[model samples]
Target: MSLLTDLKHDEQFNASEKAVAQYIITNKEEVLNLSIQALSELTYTSPSTVVRLCRKIGLKGFKDFKIKWSAELQKEYNAISNVDPDFPFTDDDSYGEIQKKILELFTDSLNQTSQLLSPDKLERAVELLLQADKIGVFAYGDTYLPALNFQNKLMKIDRSVHMAALPGENRHLATNFRQGDCAIVISYSGESKNNYYITQLLKQNGATIIVITGNPSSHIASLGDLILPVAESESQSVKLSTFSSQTAIDYVLNTLYGCLFVSNYDKNQSKRIASETLFLDERF
Candidate 1:
């Protein structure tokens, strides 16, 4: 039996579900990355109680809960932070004030994205990316900036990645892709026709699709093999560029890169050595 399943029948721990849930919601940030003993201590419960709590909630174990809890807490924080200020806390015309406001919006967006993530979704996306033969990335308008940055990061890790940065070239470039590949589409609203088309084409070619979008139920969601929800602009009064969406994309890209590094550390060593040698002339 799973460790959590074994602990479910314990009477002493049966009534603590509400308390455990509250503890998780309150101390999510601190204990989100914590071990079982650390979480138990933080929650003012015994390790066995923590284990039992996992069973109650239907998680495999404490580690599984950590991923889901951390994501939910981050999402909650993001949704709160992105909403526009009610009044002029700082004047919008002031450069310093504008900078601070932008920071708040992006930070909130990143937080919300994390909270909405499920452990199963994150794990499944990671598995797809790691196993894919090739990866294609695309974004339109503002989303393209982060897509370009993501492509660069993956290239540094020696991943075979392609991106569409030129006009009228996205479709032609995308058409060359085949099965066993992956397509990562980034859109703030997940409403872009171009992105939706790309996703549909990729799927038709037997490629797995990963969509990062602010709208979970948008048309592109249907095309996605995995849906990653970023934060959309929360201000109804002002037209703000999609800063938070890009920030969330940054976090996901970094997390995926770290996972890939760990999975291919030995192979990467040879690649890194060859890269350093090839660039030796530029170094001098």
Candidate 2:
């Protein structure tokens, strides 16, 4: 992601940092040669505030931010993605063409999601999963399906995971979770009411939070310890369907499941074998 892109998406910025970010984004060309003091002065914030913003976005300081920002501006970046996440197909398309578009849409969605879900975040999520006493999966609507799939995988692996997505029961689940427990909350917008409330409960209860979302600039994302962002291409309110978002969620959950399995490779393999054997008698 570009420096501006990070500034726009990441919700971790404070009010002062946000002011500096707005200035930098609105005056991109001006920032090319701008110093910390000058940029801060333009934004009416301090140089320290500018440096803090720089650090929040993973840069060491103003110089480091400048180095990365300059390189990104100089580099030729690609168009958003090969396929449009929202409108991958049209009314004029034949079934054959639609099939091709569907395939490509999923391909593109997974690619974008993989890029957004950085390796360090993935590693941290898995680390938390390994450390947690129990795991709870929370989501609403379309996002819940991927959470269920992940829950099933965790259960099969002998990991104690619960689907807390049931209506009216998330609060109960949240309260029940212990300090060492983990909550995997999935929401594309990152601002659902139930998710926000339940996440708040989880937070107070001292459970670790791992948020899977598309929008990082959201209240839920701020409450999370680890945020695994999905493809940011799909519009929150407008879309042909949940195709791209669903695909992205599934990819991220499956990646997590696969990573967890690989973390304890031999033990998980044996567990899978044992699980298969238990179901072997059901020929139907």
Find the candidate with the highest TM-score and give its number.
2
Off by over 4 Å in 1: 1-96, 234-238, 269-281
Q: Put down candidate 1 lDDT per residue, 1-284, tens digits, no spaces.
A: 43223343445354555455566554435565678877666667778777667766677777877776656544544444334633323431334335555767666666777787666777788799888888888777767777787778778767878887587677876787788888888776777788778777777778888888778798988888898776655442354444556677777776666667767788877777778788996885
Tell me the spans in candidate 2 whose CA falls farther than 4 Å from its real position.
1-83, 282-284
lDDT of 1 at 47: 81
Worst 10 residues of 2 by lDDT: 73-82
Task: Find the 10 residues in a row with the least total lDDT in model 1.
Answer: 85-94
lDDT of 2: 0.84
**Deviation in Å, model 1, residue 235 alpha carbon:** 6.7
TM-scores of the candidates are 0.62, 0.68
Model 2 C-alpha RMSD to native? 20.1
